[model samples]
Target: MLSSIKRFLIGRPLKSAELGEQKLNKTKALAILSSDALSSVAYGPEQILIVLITVSAAAFWYSIPIAIGVLLLLTALILSYRQIIFAYPHGGGAYVVSKENLGINPGLIAGGSLLVDYILTVAVSVSAGTDAITSAFPFLHDYTVVIAIVFVLFITTLNLRGVTESASVLAYPVYLFVVALFILIGVGVYNIVTGQVSPALHTPVGTPVIGISLFLLLKAFASGSSALTGVEAISNAIPNFKDPAPNNAAKTLVAMGTLLAILFSGIVVLAYYYGVQPIGEVTVVSQIAEQTFGRNFMYYFVQGTTALILILAANTGYSAFPLLAVNLAKDKFIPRMFTVRGDRLGYSNGIIILGFASILLILAFEGQTEQLIPLYAVGVFIPFTLSQSGMMVKWIREKPPGWGTKLFINTTGAVISLTVTLMFFLTKFGQVWSILIFLPLIILIFHRIHKHYEAVGDQLRLTTCEPSIPVAGNVIIVPVAGITHVVEFSLNYAKSLNPHQIIAVYVPFEREEEEIFEEKWKKWQPDVRLVTLHSPYRSIIQPLTRFIDTVVHKASESDYQVTVIIPQFIPKKGWHNILHNQSSLMIRAYLLYRRNVIVTTVPYHLKK
Candidate 1:
């Protein structure tokens, strides 16, 4: 039943190693990866006014120039990352970048940043999409958190179901967003050029024109840079594409870049021509929609498309996180469980984890995408710097003299994006301090994980052949939890080991253990030996440890070895730590320290 439910939630998984380069076509991969950046057209302009609204309503006009500068930077970064595909076509993405030039720590920092960024991408994109919906229907306005959660769950369920299914579900809606924005902007532009354009349904907002300064201009540029948030998503997710991996990656990059540029510029122009003004906590698009279409079908249609597109953009993260987690797992930054595969052989566990984290984040932030927006961009830009930086290294290490043109292009992109990275690190430094807290925690997870891998790697590492120890009689001691079920299973396992002695060791740590265990195991038909070491302190682990040492000391003298049989009953459905506690851990630790003893486990898998 659990397997079936898992199947239903995650979908039929895809083959993990079966992802061939030529398998995924360029157009499909582009559509999937480009969703977030393309959907930025919906809210990138909105963010500009959101920031400046505190000072004056007139700051909305400045959104145009800010978006333009960001757009230019976006183009340069795209060209830079393009060089990345040409160089290291593996799924390395940002890690390839940082590792190549900046060293391993910086590579990990890039990894940490990108992982956080993908999570924020889901929260921000979905919340922003829903915000667009609230623009049209105020009835759904107060329920953004609920809506975002439901949306994340929905995507999670689909993603767990399978990648292709998730992509296919979101593909059309993303396409719809692109087409609608293109058509609306195209119509608006054509009307203006053909002299059929009229003033916006409302007057152009020029009143209270405040003098602009460089600080304000830099702020605006930073705000527009939000459009570049998902540019690195493609690089992370290129491994998921069909065959012709490099070609598909490059093609997807170009396609994403083109559509992103078009939708963004078009939205800016539409906002400007329509004189769309900003309302704090109100949507720029909705205000313009009401003004331009005034309850017409076109307004509703465009608004709906925009909202759906935003929600689907979360798919990009769904695709990338599982893939990135696989990389992290390989690096030992995450659990090998993340590297574990499902029926379809994909990293289903990682996908589900990513989905759950996104949902929690969406709810925690109250589904306010803009509130999470500042936290989002900084990490993504960091990876952008790393990826571009890595590509520069890739070029330099393998460069010929005639590669000047390529070097020049990639170098320029790295500098431009790295500069933006620094600005965001500073301009957003105070406001986005929360992410600083989160980044270290993630990095530490990576570190602990790396450290664990090193430790485990050392444990599993073999330098020479083990000294031949002649086989002799061994004691099969089963440590029961003093429960009815534990005793029954322990005896069965002890018999199976076929050891010299089959005994059930129950440490009477507590009075209850004495009473309950004495009454429980009083009648043993097969006469299984019950060893209860006294612990006046009522500590189970200490008594068990002392008992084990005594058994080994006696057994060694008798030309016999000890095989400690531990019966662990961990129900399929129970709080993990609460049940396992210190007993199981201490037992494992003690047994592992005694290499001569063969510690065996008898597990009772009960229903939830």
Candidate 2:
């Protein structure tokens, strides 16, 4: 039944050969991977205003320059990652590039940074999406964290099913969001050009504007860089693309870049010219939507799409984080469990972990996007610097065709990213200091994991051939609750093991029960010795464990090994097992650490 439920939820297991069939084409791939980058415009434009509005209302116009700076950096990143796609076509992204070109520690830093960034991506996107919804319907504001958690769970479930399934589920809403933004941009641009735009409405803001400073401009630029968080996701997941994976991934990167540049730049222009303010209750993009489409169906439609695409943008993390975890795990930098694929060929452990981490962040922050946004940018630029620097090293060392131009491009990106990293540190370090702490802890964890794997390898290593010791005898003990077909079946399995001694042991609470079981055993004549132990406290584990210890002590004089085979029955439904008190579990637990004694469970599955 559990298997059936799992099959229904995530579909039947796919063969290893079927993985290629699961690869995504460019269009679906874009929708699945690009959602995070594309959906940033929902909050990216406003993040600038969030910082700028602190100085003064007049200082809000500085969003234009801040945005243009972000755009220039964005263009350089797009070009840099395009080079990454071609250079490390097998989905290297930052961590792989840095590890290959830079060094081990630098690679670990990149991996740790990207992993944290993906977690924040889910948290910030879902929280912002919830904020968008609450803005539309104020009544839901109280349940914001609950709503965000539910949304994260929903995305997690869809992704566990498979990447193609998730892409199909997410593609429509993302495209709908894209279409809606274009509509907002077109309508707003038309109104501006034809002189039909109305005067800006004044809304009371809870947070007031303050004095401006150079630090304020730097803070705004740093804040504006949140828009670039998901830009590397596509490059990280290039292996998920179909035939000509690198070329297709490069094209998808171009498509994502084009859409991000147009929509973000357009929103920035509209917000500035239309005189939108960073009102507390509503968003900057929402304000633009209100002005462009007014309080009509289209306005609400745009808001609805914004909420969906923002929530589904978490899909980008689901796609990339698991893949990154797999990469790290392969390098022995993390637990190898993450490398195992689930029934649908997705990295289920990594996906589930991402969801839970996001949920924790949501709960901790109470689903407030503003509180989470400051923690967002630091994770992003660390990888950006490492990856671009790695590429710069690659171009200079490899000296491929056009290597000089490529080197220049990556060098420029690395410098800009490093500069941003420093500026963000100087301007917003207090708000984002947790990243510094988190990165070091992650590096330590990677070192510990690598050490453990090395130790395990040493233990498992073999140097020379050794002579095998012959077994003098095999002792099999089957612990039974009664003389029934289950015990009979267990003895048959023990017989297959060719044991010289087969002891069917039973511990009876009452004397009459022992007499009855012995009587049945005598009549059955099961070709195995039956030993009965009396228990005053109705304890099954203690007496059985003592008997096993005696058997082990007797066998210690020879080369014989002791085996304890427990007879168990599995109920058809999972809950049915709870109704029975399992002595087998107790016996196994007690003997788990016993030396040279092997414990095996022979399960008799019940038809019902």
Pick the TM-score winner: 2
lDDT of 2 by residue, 527-546 (tens): 78999999989888888888
Clashes of 2: 1
| lDDT, candidate 1, at 134 | 82
Q: TM-score per candidate, in order?
A: 0.85, 0.89
Estimate the overall C-alpha local distance difference test score of candidate 1.
Answer: 0.74
Q: After superposition, how far is residue 549 of candidate 2 from its true place, in Å?
A: 4.2
lDDT of each: 0.74, 0.88
Worst 10 residues of 2 by lDDT: 200-209
**Candidate 2 Cα outliers beyond 4 Å, as residue runs:** 1-8, 11-17, 194-210, 461-470, 482-485, 503-550, 571-574, 605-608
lDDT per residue for candidate 1 within 235-293, as digits (tens), equals: 77766777667778987898888888887877776776676666645577666655556
